[model samples]
Target: MLTNAVPTTNGPVVGVEQGAVRAFKGVPFAIARRFAKPVAPAAWTEPRHCTDYGAYAPQPGHLDLAIEESCLSLNVWAPAADHPLPVLFFIHGGAFVTGGGADYDGSFLAAHGPAVIVTINYRLGPLGFLQLHRHGFGEANNLAMSDALAGLDWVRANIANFGGDPDAITLSGQSAGASMVIALATLPQARGKFIRALALSAPGRNIMSADHADDVARRVLEELDLAGDAGAITSVPLPTLFAAVERVSRRLADETEAGTLFGPVLDGTVIPHEPREVFADGSLCDIPLWLGSCRDEMAMFLKSMPPAAMIRTTERQVRAAFGEAGWERLLSCYRATARVDEDPYEALLSDAFWHRPMSDLARVHATAGGAVWLSRFDHRPALEPFLSQGPTHGADNACLWAHLPNFIDRPILKRMGGPMTPEDIDVAARFQANVLRFVTAGVPDIAEAWPRFEPAKEPLAIFSQPFHVIPLNDGARFRAWAELTARPGAVA
Candidate 1:
């Protein structure tokens, strides 16, 4: 299935045609050594066949999967058209420990809009993010983010050959990937590489400080029986290190206040300060921003927790997220806003982790003269028979991408896809068009005058079957959160 060669800045690479799109998979964007910064990929004399996806970074719980250290590869999906088009660079979300670009297929977005779509893979877990400054590997703590920056750098220098506009780049991501996009927008090294960003459910408050990162590193080292030994850490088998990472991660999961298990640290080089601190300082990118979270951001994760424990955790997080004076008011608002009987905990998690931080960041970005467009994805298909939970995290992805729930596996999905309804197709089409419109013009072309978010007029574009705009603070819980967040020293 090899097609004509596309000449890049480094070398000429070849791709294969899949349906209406040309896919270039397993393309190396950078080369790296363990616990070292990435360097440019080696030059090749002949065209490199990039048809199959490369290896993913080694992670625990997936021992059967291939793993490697030099795993900074990316996949490109471009339309068959000859003219240049806009580019959408996506990063996958796996809580910064697992997941890779290969998990996603971007051909739908590529063919539908005739735009080039690039999904990249970065290092994960202990190998990528554990702080090692105390042990002398200070530069490698944020290798995952550095890998993403290298991928963006590759696109900036070489996307033109794939009929993509280098200047019209839109950085888009979900979950952990969304956080990376926000971090890139804040960092100086990644400035000017992207025109705008589309952040889908960014966990804006999970970044760890250097000290916390060091603590996690020490625990992992102790678990692996390599305490205070830099040589063993650098040379240990990945499986042994990954098992230790799992022990540390499982132990920290109970500490809800603890940040992500293995994620970007504010190491003073890559990520200068905490994300909240950066957003508060109004130093974010001044481009147009489109960001939002789902209605049930925690349902997927809370499935394992007992009802009483979940309720207790929600109650505790409420005060930390908001403040002391209005804890009762906030809980009352949450209970009143619960759409279902078992929804209060989901509501609490959504506000504390997703909506509240997103709103805060929107305010700061607007204050910095950036146009902010916010939304809430509340579309739950009637055909979701696998789980009763409504519109959980990453649910909007079904309508946004070609990988609709109907097209996926499971007995329920098969039956649903067997007879796709007009409403389903219509909704999917509308979302894809709006997303492409934003990618092309830097702002979503909706029916109404999509107002930019302000302190008073917190406008939001709600994406439903009938997409429309409403004040972000419309509901009781939202109003209460808006008031609580406006006060000094709110954590969310």
Candidate 2:
């Protein structure tokens, strides 16, 4: 019996049914050309078999894997074609360079609920985000985001066939994917694609101006030694072009300390304005928002720094960036909150980069009379014995999705392998429930009510071993950093 057969807006797709859930994989929503805007896929009359995941965007390390230009596809998981369910539209994150929607499994989430989940794959790295249209490339600015828009359009047009309510869509993502959600929330083009958004660990500061984007593109050309011939950037061998992207990215990171080498740029057409400015002005669509960061968002990166350098150079750099007065306040705050001497640097960075920026965004949104609930994911991983610290960047992902990321190395898993403790199990269940509830009902379904964020009450959902809510714990030092960032030329 071909029970999984479903009709999409453009074609008939045959998926696989297992128990209550049916999944369709590698369904092309758009056809993409290298460094160009994605176009609608050609319609098909025959049933297209969508049983396996499709090829993902090209990245640096996966050279041996078969990469392709037509990689704009989406995977869907639903209960049945007859029931209308809430839709969770998810975007995957890999620092804006790598990652496929397949890395995150939505079957568990969809099977346990009255909801349908869709995960999309967009262009990454130079192929996706590099703004090369100035040199005759076609709409190269924010190509990754453009691909996301196209996928959202497809969902709006065809999710009904997958048992999803097109009007009750929740856009959700983490890390770089969270950044895209924030971008869509601010951009005029994405006003009604999703009714609400759940942005986890949104790096609201990644969006750069058009001039900076063009500068990066120019440096990429220079790195490839094609400075005089900009058009050659598109014609170079794929491997060589990827190598040049790596070199240019590493150079940018070394010199400027940027998190992502290529991402959503403030091109006048695609992204109208700097994202921070847009969020601050309360220009985002009036959608309920659930967003926050990990308690130790920077510790994952800090683990790689030499212990001595982290102790000595990190604070010194902080002082150099801020002033003497600012440094003193930051030190006081760090000392007040630090668990150990080595923790001060990590705390400073965590607040400055992730926590503070998001807090500011919440403040602006709440002031604009939007419904917002903020939280901090404090649950540490039960795995990974090599690290001495608790829940760092990407740590909450395992708990949030109830599955480990595809990139988790087998050796690391083996050495630190352990069953989820009772505490871990409880937290994961509650966290997943709250997320599903928020997507379905516009509020969390935890044991206690998740309060709306206000300046005085400052409610937050702290997801620890026994998940609970609390008043804002970030102290005056965090507020100082937020104020400093609001000033021009301070941080972005």
Candidate 3:
């Protein structure tokens, strides 16, 4: 049965109950005005009915959700348990552009895990990531990062009231959200807030240098015809602001690698040092990490590209980044390892952008004496479009949240191929069980079979029909990618 009211730091909130799960949706975690830091919401005595989701952060109009500036809210799903449970704090991925806490329904994970699940909404696009500190917008740099921090603060202070162990929070995220997890793990302010981290399909690089962010900010301002009038930014209508963001992003796409126009900035104040540097130096070795990428991450993005053009473009880029000899060696390795009918270009792009960087991070984290588990989602669903793509980007989400019926038809899963089969459900159950183990015990239950990542053996769990852990055997392929990623201006 649903609780009459759950006390929070700011006030009491009423939630909906379904079977053994209690879900509190659109609970305000923080309040913020445009271009300002988030602050605690006003306290209230009357219980707030957070039965419906709050408006999404002002973003490019796409998802048919209400957009507003006061979007710093979070959702929670907890089992009907008396004792406090471990909390899984998940961040949604939308390439720092689209997505919201409501996009993911945590009821399934919460019920099955018997753990509290928290999903959050943070600012997005120009409204969130535009770094304008150098342009006299002091409170604007890394606003989304700040929003995440604010949410964490709220959780740490009040999650226990909702039947969660505040001290045992596991920070988990995917894609752009995964990058945020990496950033938070490295941030000194975020220490002690979460016990462990899980990152899936984190981009090779999402942090933008302050100078680069400044350039993007200036371009955005120029597009809006408010170049020198930084004060006018706060008053610009959402549509006008987003239109300028789109224009600036299009112009910068060709100028920058991967068209990454906006993301967290190394403002020297919020994020003092680079995340890779922190990971390499062993500073973050104490926290346990579970991270991985899909087998073919780029297939989703390259699906629309004509086969002939895809091959030509991939060849031109590969040859330019890596010499002809390097290209041949890489191609040979991929031809041997890639799935049947998988495009060489798609495989190469996936490796260069997602797989290689994840592997490198795993090796360094493990080398530094950190407890880490690495895995790859290789299970291709027995469905149409996804069968052609073969475990493409965001496919794991389909398995991870398969228990949530409402979630099954969401874009991340539906577009990847939904209406899961019996085989697919079996795989999902196994994946969720392992994830729950990690969230509760700080280590996956498959530890006996899947040993901690070691640089020498490079042990990695392959999540497929017959899930198994195997030491990485493709040194040649990774070596080729390492060289390409090391090249200047390479997106990897």
Best by TM-score: 3
lDDT of 2 by residue, 1-492 (tens): 245568988789998875678889889999877777999889999999998888867776654573656689999988854568999999987778778887766887887666899999998888888888886775788999999999999999999888899999999988899999888777788777788888888764658677767878888888889888887776787788888887776566545534246778888898887666776676653688888688887777676643312223344556667777777877777777677634776788777667767877787778777778898888776766313668777666667766322213322112333457666677777778888888888877543577888666677788886777776745666576666656666633
Q: How far is candidate 2 from the true structure (C-alpha RMSD, Å)?
A: 3.7
Higher-scoring candidate on TM-score, 2 or 3: 3
Candidate 3 per-residue lDDT, tens place, 433-468, comes to 889999998887555888888877778898887888
Which residue window of length 10 is worst by lDDT in model 1?
A: 409-418
Instruction: Sort the candidates on TM-score, descending order.
Output: 3, 1, 2
Q: Model 1, 1-492: lDDT tens per residue?
A: 887998887788999998989999999888887888889878987999999887776665554565565588899998866678999999888777777777677888888887899999888887778887677775767888999999999999999888898998999988888988888777779778988888898874546677888888878888888786765788787788888887786676566556346666788888876665665676664678888788777777677444323334555666776656678787677787676545775677677767777877888787766778888877664445314777777766656764543433222112233233566566667777878888987777743557668777888777767877787767777778778877888755
Clashes of each: 0, 0, 0
What RMSD does each model have against the real structure? 3.4, 3.7, 3.2
Off-target runs (Cα >4 Å) in candidate 3 are: 62-67, 305-321, 336-338, 382-388, 404-407, 411-418, 479-492
Alpha-carbon TM-score of each model against the true structure: 0.90, 0.89, 0.92
lDDT of 2: 0.76
Worst lDDT 10-window in candidate 2: 404-413
Give the lDDT of residue 141 in candidate 3: 85
